[model samples]
Target: MRRRLRVLVTGAAGLVGAEVTARLAAAGHEVTALVHRTPVLVGNDGTPLEAAGVRCLTADVTRPRLGLSEADHEALAGGIDRIVHCAAITDFGRPEEDYQRVNVDGTAHVLELARAGGADLVHVGTAYVCGERDGLILETELDEGQRLANAYEASKLRAETLVHKARADGVRSAVVRPSIVVGDEHTGVVRDYKNIYVVLKLTTEGKVRSIPGQYEARLDLVPVDYVADVITQVTERFDEAAGRTFHAVGAPLTLRDFSDVMAEYPSFQVPRFVPPTSFDLGRLPREERVYYERVVALYESYFRRRMAFDASNTAQLVARPAPGGGQDFLRRLIDHCLESGYLGAPLPGVADVLARLDLTGADVSGPAANDANGAGR
Candidate 1:
């Protein structure tokens, strides 16, 4: 028989967090949800989490030590047996300092909560923490000190450091790194509007005139549900799983192929996957280079990286393989987002108030437009 567990989940309203929390609840584990703000969306029951047997607590994750009042901290520490940390800034373009504060320092604070509760910690990290373009990114391997393309990776690396240190301090911790998470394979419901969705929307909005290549650059994407499933399954084996990291990535799918599926949407055209050297940057005027950078920065950042995410640990531990990858998966994802009205959804009225225009670019592939630090994980 298994012990009934009390689990606290950070980033409870996030895409992955929502799914994982729901799964955990379904398994009869008590779940405590920590949200950054007023929690509107609830679990699968279409009501408040408390109604679903979850204790919902609201706090800013970026606060020093999570800004928890004594009552809140004691409330968190008293009954929690495990913590699933899904909070972190995922946007690659956020200022390095901001990323460090949230992804790195924020993780330490979450660890503190877990420590106070004597709970095993499960942290959701990204596979890109493997760092800039190189060779195989192994699941069990880490901290080769790989060069980072942006701040997001750097901060996550710092966060991973914090979690590992906690493990060393007897926190009984484990980390999961997912690469390019997409929508559900069966349902095609994706709330994330960044990453590939940005590119697809731009194409439909006519931001891109030419793809410049056959879109053949190999890309990787994994389904979110699959990741949630793996997280749930792995957390159950905490004693052996502690201190381990697993990569939730699918088999390699090329960018061109990704676009082919995405282009099925009215806005996106099949990408041109010409070799990077095939296009001469010098031919463009100074301003065009800047403009081109805005238009293609996201694509460039991802396509420029050349490596495979090897998830042997994920496969071995979860007994599942990445589902619905490559071209078909991409098209289905784009279609779902478009039909769901997520792509190019009107910014909320307060976007002007909260909008960080300094971080946005005119091009679709530019930095994130909303709050998500990055796309799926």
Candidate 2:
């Protein structure tokens, strides 16, 4: 039997963090959900974490002692046996200073809390920390002197380095580097529709014409549930995962596969992928150019490159296989977006389109089909 632990989870109100908190609570672990602003601990299904016995506390990771009172700090230090550091500004377009402040300096504060509490630490990071380096990325590798795509990538790399350095100071720490996190694998329920959804939304809305990318470039999208599950598992088996890094990723879809799936939907106009060198933004229509510059530009670096993440360490620990990519998963994600009204109300004649495509399986019709309005509850 796994030992019950008091786990302190940062970013407990966010998408991935809330799921982790819910899973930990379901597994009989005492969860202290640290939230900076929103104190609600609800899952995508609207299930309250408080109902699941999660203790919510308002605290800022950027502040000293997590912005907690001395009494709260001492109480946490006494009670928290493990710390899951999931709080970080994930917005790619944010300024460099924001990334340095939150992803880098915020990590330092979490490490201090872990040290003071004498707790094992589980740090959630991104696989893009490998930056512009192509080919296979191993869990053991941190710095390869590769060029980073954005401030987000650089900051996470530095944060992971801090965690690695903390191990030398006797802080037992493990890092979970998850690739682009998407919706739930089974239900396709998602709270936040950032990251890959931006591309889909822009394409489907006809906001952009062409995207500069390699058609064969791999897009490593993992479900949030899988990422959360693996992190919770690592926390449960902390003794084995100490001082190790796990890649919480799966088989990624190539840009061609992504485009092919998007093409299945009638409303979407799959953007043609052009090589970055040959592609000229000036050639685009004025509206498309402006949209690309304002919105799509933030993520252009990712679509242009390909990188494979090896999750062998994580695979050895988790029972389920890594999530797969391709048409089925992509369809489910888009369908959920449509059903949830996140992508705006489904285009007219979507039902006719669904019928013509014959894509509706028993699973697709289970819950999503019942919601005709595609509005969020």
* Best model per lDDT: 2
Task: Please provide, for model 1 over 186-263, each residue's C-alpha lDDT reduced to its tens digit, 9 standing for 90 to 100.
Answer: 666776666666656655543343344434445677788888888887777777677788887766676656655555
User: Candidate 2, residues 1-377: lDDT per residue as tens digits?
Assistant: 88889999999998889999999998999999999899777786667666455889998888888888988888888889999999999977888998998889999999998898899999999999999999999999999999998889999999999999999988999999999898888878888889778778877765565778888888888889999999999999999998889999866888898878877877666677777787776666544666688888988888877789998999898787888856688788989998887775545443346667987555333222221121111
Inter-residue clash pairs, candidate 2: none
Off by over 4 Å in 1: 42-51, 210-216, 262-267, 273-295, 341-377
Per-model TM-score on C-alpha atoms:
0.81, 0.89
Question: Candidate 2's error at 115, in angstroms?
Answer: 0.6
Candidate 1, residue 339: lDDT: 74
Candidate 2 residue runs with Cα over 4 Å from true position: 344-377
Worst 10 residues of 1 by lDDT: 368-377
Q: RMSD in angstroms, candidate 2?
A: 9.6
Each candidate: what lDDT? 0.70, 0.84
